[model samples]
Target: MTVLLTIIVVALVGITFWQMSKILKLSQLKNVDTSQVANDKDNDTQGKLMLGFVIFIYVLTIYCFSAYNSFFLPESASKHGVEYDQLMLISLVIIMITQIITQGLLHYFTFKYRGKSTNKALFFADNDKLEFVWTIIPVIVLSALIIYGLFTWSDIMNIDEEDGDPLIIELYAYQFDWRARYGGEDNVLGKANVRFIEGVNTLGVDVSDSYGKDDKIVNELHLPVNRKVIFKMRSQDVLHSAYMPFFRAQMNVVPGMITEFSYTPTKTTEEMRNSEFMVEKVATINDIRREKSKALIAAGDEGLETYEFDYYLLCNKICGASHYNMQMKIVVEPEEDYNAWLKEQQTFGEQMSAQASN
Candidate 1:
């Protein structure tokens, strides 16, 4: 009944608009060009407006690029990230050039050839040379770009097991949080499934599986600098994206299937924090936080904490209401430090046994 009423109301509103349009048309003065065809004056004014609009857009683009340049991400932090950034920069350059040429020609031609009373429109059925020039140019450009992109993609995605004995890890995603599972001494992640989820077994590891007995799970992601790390991703509730912006790494996490991505961290967390770019960014963020903290303190609330630089693993996809808060800190450290940290964490078997004892 509610749907029917909504439909009726929508129909009435539409009909009322139709009637109003008819009345407006009928009410126009007889001398007015009711045919709604463009006249010489109309064309001239519209052409000038188009020209002005194009100029305005160009100025806005320049202003935005200059003013927001500082907000752009700092240099990539992974080995492949350099290549990824290069490809991105090339694509943007090409796009910018194409946009400038096409938009400039479009607006210039619109204004230069705008309709006039004495003008005679030219008609052409076909022009083979023109067609060939337009078609072949785009084909060549697109084909080259596609080929280059494919090669880059292949290089990034090609995970050779023989290469550097990459560390194996699992990134498990859920509605509002993430979990990192490290392959223990065997360096082989065990089998897992959503159905196996139970108390103290959040990631649903196959407890009976020998490979899983030594698996370690933690909330924070830790990577060894200069070491190739392969991440296997899985989602339990809904589709999610595992995004590590600094590494230029992102892969979809789908339920019932394991996705993979790999990258070698080139900088440790402390190294990145100490970099000039990061230092400036951290200072700017802290300044903003301090300003906000003053207001909170005045209202009898504790001031905000000082901002610091840290890499993060974020859920790029909007999975649920709390998706904005779905992130985990990523710490890249020396191989020895990473080993020490991993050694301190309990294995799945130990955790399960302890839970049982309790």
Candidate 2:
């Protein structure tokens, strides 16, 4: 009944609009004027409206940048994140400046020089100087941006192994879930093959391989603060992307191949959670959740829990129906706590040997 009423209301509104349009057309036809048909007032009104919209865009952009700053991810936790953020800011500033100039001029011209039948347009088939100015300016600007981008890419891709003793961790991607294998005290990951994956051997670490003996498989990813983490990524069935927004890290995980990305974690989960901005964000989230939970309870459904800040490893690629659920919790902690947790995990070889004995 409510839906029917809504449909009827919408139909009535549409019909009213149609009738108004028809009446306007008939009125214009009956009262046609030779001098006032295409007046400056109408053109100016339209141009002004467009210019007002542009101004609204500018104001909205500023409002969003300021008002919703806390909703954006907190400060990056990786070493190269500052550089990455600077590059992004440079690109955004360039784009915003160009947009403002072009849009302002476009609307201003429409208002400043409305169409007049007596006026003639200045036409030039070609202007080499003007064309060269526009072309060379963009070329130089784009070339510089491209060169700078290339240097950044090179720096990220070519990591110096000798710079620090990076911890090795393997990220295995499957259809609907993720698993992480940490290279134990040896700091070396053993050979892995998809074919050997069965039951408990989810990551297919070769038990026979000595290095694989100490490989620790875990559901959650744990990283030591202030230490470099080198993730060796792999996929069993389809392509996936490992994305960590807070760390400003993303890398492709291709099937039957290993891809690598390295980053140094600078902060722990507790530190991030305690940050003023994050604390405010959490309060906001919990407030929203409380309202949603009330609605859920009214509908006889489970209520939502309060929110907390935590690092996450999420799959960015759409692999399958369950792709959205492909994620793992990541915890950054002090070296001692991380090592203590690591030691408590069962090694692949130990699990395999125990199963064999059984």
Please write out the lDDT profile of model 2 over residues 123-161, one tens digit for every residue.
Answer: 989999999998998899889988988888787777665
Q: How does model 1 fare in lDDT?
A: 0.94
Candidate 1 C-alpha lDDT tens digits along 62-139: 999999988989899999999899888988998999998899899989999999999999999999999999999989
In order of appearance, the predictions have TM-scores of 0.88, 0.86
Candidate 1 lowest-lDDT run of ten: 28-37
What lDDT score is found at residue 356 in candidate 1?
97
